[model samples]
Target: MDPAKLSNAIENVHRAGMPGLFAEVRDGDEVWRGAAGVADLSTGRPVTADMRHRVGSITKTFTAAAVLHLVDGGEIGLDAPVGRYLPELVPGERGDAITVRMLINHTSGLGEYLPYAYPSLRAFPDLAECRPQSLDDHRLTRFDSTELIEMGVTAPAAGAPGGTPGLYSNTNYLLLGQLLERVTGVAAEKYITQNVIERAGLQDTEFPDGPQINGPHSRAYEAFFGMIDPPRDYSVFDMSYAGPSASLISTVADLNRFFGLLLAGEIVHPSSLARMQRTVPIVSQEGKVIEYGLGLYPMEAAGGGIFWGHGGTTWGAGALSMIRGDGGRRMSVAMNLQRWNTLDASGRPQPHPIDDALAALYRVAMSG
Candidate 1:
């Protein structure tokens, strides 16, 4: 496929409804970068391919790699019980049954803590609900990791530990962060920065210290499923609520570099990479099916072969990165606006132009 096709696809995305978007695609030695749309709708400032953006849950891969570093050092066991290391946090039979592997793979059968943290999101039976009003309520509130983890632990178990079709939960990643702190004698973010981010040679990625972005960055615009008219900017909001699970800020280029190096066995050993690529049937927060691995997932391009990567989203930002199995091709994309779809009577997102445009863009980006 021609790079122009991908460029046009990005333009189509903005025209379809996205506020702004930037993307990078790689084919062996050939690379292409493009941006289309505004960085700030208020000022009409354009977005660039190199600007830093919140990569959201893509932070999970970094966290997983950091944990694997300890695995490579023979300091942590993948199947070890969480209770053995963090009894104070996970405690009792439930903790003993949930292994580190379960935590990373999200088969620990733990519940989500989002609804508990942001009460407006609670749907009663589970924490798998979302409410835009809650986003405004907690914009500046800093949440502690332990507090979040307990919400998941105390909630009724989603299923037995290591069960099939595991549930996706931020609580799992927070536990991983606690595990990292236990073993490394430092904050999880510190260990990951020193090990995974630094080792990947990613310069723009970091666990932000505060609500403000450090350098050049597009403002994050979220619609909360179109509940907020004209969308709202959450660019300066604190991310501590999601810390290890979804707080890392990065650029598209850095994301491509990280995934590329990860697949090439530069950050952790090849065996560790193999473990990260192992996928299982899992249910996402949106109740969608995803082939989730330790912190990675597979996206099959149209006849382009299997690509392994991850997609992440914050309140008003979204990003996805993918690389071929052989590491010869890749694509990393970021967008400023999120959840542009409005909900109808069924509580499902009504069809919108942006959704189709984003799908088309990915198809072109990953085309062979």
Candidate 2:
């Protein structure tokens, strides 16, 4: 891979509308890091390669690996029902049917609780109605995971348990968090921090205890599907609502090390890694079809090659970390902007330069 070409791709993202972005690529022992645009548009602070950023749903991969670590040690069962562990949270008929496997793969049929939690953004499948009140109101609110899970479980099931074309739901991951606490005798975040992050030797990765990120980082900006006239900075926000599902603060270098180790069986046992790659069809929040495994997904690259990783976004921060199937090449990127597209008259997202730039960036990052 050409570092100059990769660097040019990142610069294009900013020129094409991204507020800021930082990325790292690994081709064997050689490494390249690049950053573009201003991190804080107001202060004009530039982004850097080593800065910590909220990596959103990539946290799910950590949670899933920690759970599967228990499986490797015979502390948990892959197919065991969550109700067996947290009956009070899951309970009754519904709990009995959905297995741990289903939760990891988002096939448990639980509906997403986001719409209920953020009533202002409840008009799902319709980005045109997006608003920022709930996000603003609860910026520092520490949410109880159980309360959040109940909002999802009690609402309705998107499909039957083990059904094909599963719906992606954060509720399932919240339940897994509860299960982690029950089995580990510690909070899910703590267990994952110890077992996964520490084990991966990722010094720059951690689950935040509160709203503030402890080190240097970019100011995250959210557009709310272009409802917010000017994208608002949400750099400091409580992540309890996302819990073990989405709240991870990390850097690009650490992400590369972690995902690389994960694919090489240095973290979970090879057998468990196999299960993590066993995919099922999932209908994402935006109604896009993605092949999801435990927490990782198999992404088909430009040349029909496969890369395993996850992409995630919070109010204003987003990231994607991916490693080639052979573990020979890797890419991890963190961005300061989220949902930058404006909605069209038909309530569909109008194409923006950011999308094309990002698509081009990934192609270059993954190419040889």
Judged by lDDT, which candidate is best? 2
Candidates' C-alpha lDDT: 0.90, 0.92
Model 1 C-alpha lDDT per residue in residues 1-368, reported as the tens digit of each score: 58778889999999998989999998877889999999999899999999999988999999999998899899999999999999998999988999999999999999989888988888733322556688888999999899999999998888999998999999999999999999989999999999998888889989999999899999999888777888999999989999999999999989999988999999989999999999998998778878899899998887658989988999899999988899978899999998787877667778999888888888888873
- 148-231 per-residue lDDT for model 2 (tens digits): 999999877889989979999999999999998999899999999999999999999999888999899999999877877689
Alpha-carbon lDDT of model 2: 0.92
Off by over 4 Å in 1: 124-130
Clashing pairs in 2: none
lDDT of 2 at 33: 97
TM-score, per-candidate, Cα-based: 0.97, 0.98
